[model samples]
Target: MPRPLMHRRHVLQGGIGIAAWLMQPGARAQVAAEPAGASAADFWRLARAGGCVFLMRHGATEAGLGDPPGFRLDDCRTQRNLSEAGRAASRQLGLRFRDEGVRLSAVYSSAWCRCLDTARLAFDPHYPAHQIWPALNSFFQGQGDAAAQTREVLQRAATLHPPDNWMLVTHQVNITALTGAFPAMGEVFLTRADPQRPDRLSLLARLPA
Candidate 1:
């Protein structure tokens, strides 16, 4: 059977978390594509006001899942990297944040090259590279500790105060584990560390890739 067509706009609700997927026109973006509305403004407001962590999946990859056999973490040549379109999306993401005057206290990336490249490409051309956190690394292939890493993200997020926002450039698996929102490459999810619930993050809104 043919797969069902995806809706351009929709809402997924659960517990105290509410995710409004707003897709912008001409935007290679998130879960659902829609014309921007009040959600976009509110998302930016939260970002600028700080006290939030933006979870970003790395820019689009060349192709394929996980890494090839015998791939090494230190070698980009051995892994799946970003494509031209992905690079363009990444650059646009950084520009969007800059144009909005949003301030991020820290920008972290997974040790993976794709994640690192997304961080460096976005925000600024000379983004001073990245601060690699193993906790944000991909466990997609079942090679890392999902439960432990998720805890680390929640713990760190709880420490962030308002006016001190943060960004974590990580993989799809990591983001899903934290918020249960599977995102597109270069997609950004506005989330806050839920101290009361160490097991989850509060999803505010989602931005396109």
Candidate 2:
């Protein structure tokens, strides 16, 4: 049996809490391929050529949903953070990128501790991950300024071209909203922004975590 084809419209219709569904156990193992007729192999080949942005959800975090009340961005203890397994997975992910010989032009991360940690632990020492503030923050649980932040991220991505891949370590909601796909923890998607349509993104491939 073949998987159902995914249309751009289908992704746009993914309603609220889509991010929550993606966080379920075994979620990371679920592979979302290119729309039925698209060639998966070709997507990877293009991705390696570096003409797109890589949207990455942070690695697994300690047990929790959203954040505890009064969470502070500067305080890791007040927020749900990465577990040891998550750290190991992040490191392995970085090695995988290295193994692929993917040269990144820039790596940006949300200010949230988990995102910052993921980018640093995984891509640092090779690519210095920089903070892009709210550009990649989670807005699912009523975080404000999501629209503005997303616009900023997309705007930055549009200016980039080949031989330079931009990797953004962000939240699931943000990724879903942009590309209409809910990326699991540690999942990375090679995506290209539609210059004419700033709100739309074309998912090229699901890079192994």
Candidate 3:
């Protein structure tokens, strides 16, 4: 059977310029040098030391442009969905995390389908009922109430007893708002949330895309 044609409306809608941003020579170099030490143990050790939050962008999607002017949040089926590559990538990321024995106490994601899908495929089995944190939504064209939302999420994550590690799957703008750096697809930014110095977070690592 022939595959159904993909429509522009069905294109996963979030940010459109990520590929161009990532393709920049400097950006490519940054990503290339972003990963931590070769061994998974090294990555775990880094995650443990700082008790940082893992902020990730959604996996690849079929969307070619930003959301339409009248996009409705409740009707995801009418919006863009994950591409085959994206679905595979999400599963692979989950497998990698499992193999690495990364302990995640909480899983949070943006309300967008791509982010939600990534969180579902990547961590739902381990951390059921992944929470939706709207602040983690994409900041396309840098327009949104992302900063306030990010602060609220960070505040909540900090108060968790025993200080368990958290994984937040969000969009570039939300991640950038918190870290002052734009993350590529599948990239993760680890940072500590300290109220005394709200802006004193450190960049532990930028996971591979």
For each candidate in turn, the TM-score is: 0.80, 0.80, 0.73
| C-alpha lDDT (0 to 100) for residue 147 of candidate 3 | 50
lDDT of 1 by residue, 1-209 (tens): 22233223211211111221122122123233232342777889888888989999898777576689999999999998988888888988888888898887788989998998889889645334468899999876466887788888888888889888888999877787777666766778898877675677878877765
Query: Model 3 misses residue 58 by how many Å?
Result: 0.4
RMSD of 1: 9.0
What lDDT does candidate 2 reach at residue 195? Answer: 70
Q: Residue 72 in model 3: shift from native, Å?
A: 1.6
Model 1 CA deviation exceeding 4 Å by range? 1-38, 124-129
Prediction RMSDs, each to the true structure: 9.0, 7.3, 7.6
User: Per-residue lDDT of 1-209 in model 2, one digit per residue for the tens?
Assistant: 34344434334433335745455444344434454544546556776888789999898777666678999988988998988978999999888778777888888888889999999989986776565667788876668665677677778788889888888998887887667677767778888877776765778777544
Deviating ranges (above 4 Å) for candidate 2: 1-16, 19-34, 37-43
Per-residue lDDT of 193 in model 3: 68
The 0-to-1 C-alpha lDDT of every candidate, in the order given, reads 0.75, 0.75, 0.66
lDDT of 3 by residue, 1-209 (tens): 22234344433332345454454334444332333443445556766653668888888767566566666668776555667887888888887776766677888888888888999998887655689877776656545654567668667656644346788898765665566566666766766666675643445566655
